[model samples]
Target: MARASATPRSSAYLSALSQEIEKKLQRALASPPQRRNLLQELFADVALEVDDRARDIILSREEDTISPADDSHLGQLCFYDVLADYYVQAPESGKPILDLIVQLWSQSFASHIFSLLFHKWLFEVQLDNPEVLLRYSSALAQGATNVFWIDIQTNTRRFQSLFCYLLDEVAVEPARLNKIPVQAQRDLYLLLSRFILFYNSGDKLDTFLKHCPTFPNAFLIGGPTDFFVTELADQLQKLKVEPVLLHYLSNLKVLQGMELRMATSTRLKTCLYSFTSPGGPMYPTRAVRHAAWDALDLLFPLFDWRSRTLHPVYSAHLQRRSTA
Candidate 1:
């Protein structure tokens, strides 16, 4: 029964997969005219199925998977490539077209979106691979660090082995990011922005804080709190990234009358006012503990921890939510 046919893993996988396919299809459009035309024709049917709402989902989901060469995007050239219409056509507004598309798609497709998305991405990855997808054995694993934000209630520790594997194995290469084409960079930024919203992912708060200023792909990067801060997290630092963490979290905290303290070398002995809500918006109380954790990230990642210390003045802010 359609009513009973919903599961988190299946849905998340599909959403992730759809994004990969969209990315590959866009990349493929840059090839020779003959191939380009062929690809466009192939997707013409898919394009036809996409109305305004479908357009939004396909465009936003398209960029999450950026290939080394974008061979997958060859799915472009279709009379109605979602990417073609949004990025190629839409002008820069206060909000980008990509964001607009995904927001629109979420209204009706919420239930089936992720599962449908995962299938699209899997097929796209296997399109070039004659073999079954050996790559995605770890794709879900790649997303492991991000699971915390997916549903905080889910036990994240269960996936530790997979996270270790990613650390030991596959991840974003610092070198290749530069070699990426401009279109890809643009596409990814939009994709990241939208997916963060779709996932209701707070993990990106760290990503926003780290890369929002230059968040190349709003949807692509995750905030610091996300345990997924592996190579990609550090690799992004190589470029100028925009940190949007405070902005989003501040908004959330405002509702709960909470205060946020970014990690710094300073201590918070002089600080006051605790964000009482345990899981409403803010996190566990231990300011001294969280501040120390942030300082470690800021000062010496490899150095020892100092239990007794109060240094520079810690910077922090507070907010309350809208009564309306």
Candidate 2:
């Protein structure tokens, strides 16, 4: 059986489906059912297809993706390609998506682990093919590390949700449960932590701070305003990942969709940025980031359901910053 593999041709199919999904997402969100039945169905369809029979699947959810069928009903929606197009067509559709993302974040840590699992799968698949993997890895990071606010305006939900859910979930849980190799986990964590900043979870931050050994994955740690970079810095030091943080002294643009130059600082253009070691992870340079970001943007709301557990982000500028 030829499952959906990551080929240009198969991508063409997903690319088309994504467009329709974007259009439908608007209708679905504006008039969402009071119950979660229909949206949940879409989630199930995408999840099953991606998991059960996706061979040419350009991208899969993280290793620890949560299925809706999980014992606790804590399913994960980590496929950004499924939701990116929805974001492109209907930026306003993000409300429900955001609700779903927060729900995943707040409700089930196990479901979120799927994100990690998917990461392991993607990177591991690339290990034998060094040339292709490096580029794909970057695209994965850009979309994976994407924040919800960016998705509200652009089409990066599928990738963003997977990264955020995995990083946060892993950080919050006991490290003993992770069977993934240390080097691989550090590499993925570095990319995942870059644009992700979780608030109101005091000890969770503490836990992430504790596990970073040599600090190879510092790219994942950052200090965003409205929250506080210094606090993030302090936490990074406590967790022994300060070396990695220091390596990431300057922020690169990680958000893929932006005006380049917004009207004001408030509208500064942004792009997703990720680090790549030469001769390193999947899609080492361009392919991963480009393909994944494009696909994630292509699918948006449907694939990238926003978190239900997370509340609104109030933008209060402390000092100006940019991901560009």
Candidate 3:
């Protein structure tokens, strides 16, 4: 009877302990040493249970139902609240702590780490707020772009699958894009566009782009030689986002080189030169041309395609290769 009573008492004690720790975490996360050190203390005190409880708190919602705001709070609090400022104030001391959290949490609870970082990136920088986006894009554009790349680099398959899962969740049925808010739709569009534009140089980025759903391989590979550009062109036609589509394709052409095989289509070839064939060329407006050239110039130095021809540099090279 005494032992039975002790068991309930122990249960109650642990429950109280958990509540105390949670309350402390909420408060502690708001400040400095507490912001960083409290996490360490929690790890020491609660050990692996920290992962379980934190994961449960974070993953409480169905993945599809979770919003950027939901996933962003902790990361925003940690970075924008005081910790990042602390890092700025004392890089030598604070950098290690911030780095440790990013490293250890990533290793231990990758999904949670990814959720925090990805949504933080979206909510902080990738939102439809023009002022915020422009400021962030100017201040730390590379860092903003690196957020997605770093997550993918951390664990290729996991992050890729996670991204696809998130995409599926946001892609509501029937109404499709109309299901997401107009702002959210624009933000999502920017996210995709930035992925194409910013990370256009690396091999992993190339492989990622080639395989991503927007350029799915099954539809791309094993088709006719002339069909490569057409496949993407047709897909873009269906989506009807002509400006974004043309600009993205131009970035891919510059980055991927002959890999895109845009010259394979004779009609596409002519349109590439004229840049004014409204009836046939997808890039009908000057705005679309400028956007494409902007992406190209950003990635490639002195990339004045007007003074020179892309066909001489890229298309001619592509023509020599055997289609088989």
Could you say which candidate leads in TM-score? 2
Q: lDDT tens string, model 2, 1-324? A: 012223344345555655544444444444545224444444444434245444324344345542222211123333443333223333344334433433333222212222322333442231345433443344334334333223323432333434434556443344421434444455554543443442222324445545553443234432222122323333332221322233222221222232222221122111111211113232223343343233223322113245533112112211111210
**Prediction RMSDs, each to the true structure:** 17.6, 21.6, 17.7
The candidates, ranked best first by TM-score, are: 2, 3, 1
67 Cα displacement, candidate 3 (Å): 23
Between 1 and 3, whose TM-score is larger?
A: 3
In order, what lDDT does every prediction score?
Answer: 0.29, 0.34, 0.36
**Model 1: how far is 83 from its true place, Å?**
23
| 1 versus 3: better lDDT goes to | 3
Task: Give the Å shift of residue 188 in candidate 2.
Answer: 4.7
Q: Give the poorly placed runs of model 3, Cα more than 4 Å off.
A: 1-27, 34-147, 172-180, 192-310, 315-324
Q: Which has the greatest lDDT?
A: 3
Instruction: Check candidate 3 and list the clashing pairs.
Output: none
Angstrom error at residue 142, model 2: 2.0
Q: Tell me the TM-score of each prediction against the true structure.
A: 0.24, 0.29, 0.28
- Evaluate residue 290 in candidate 2 and report its C-alpha lDDT on the 0 to 100 scale: 40
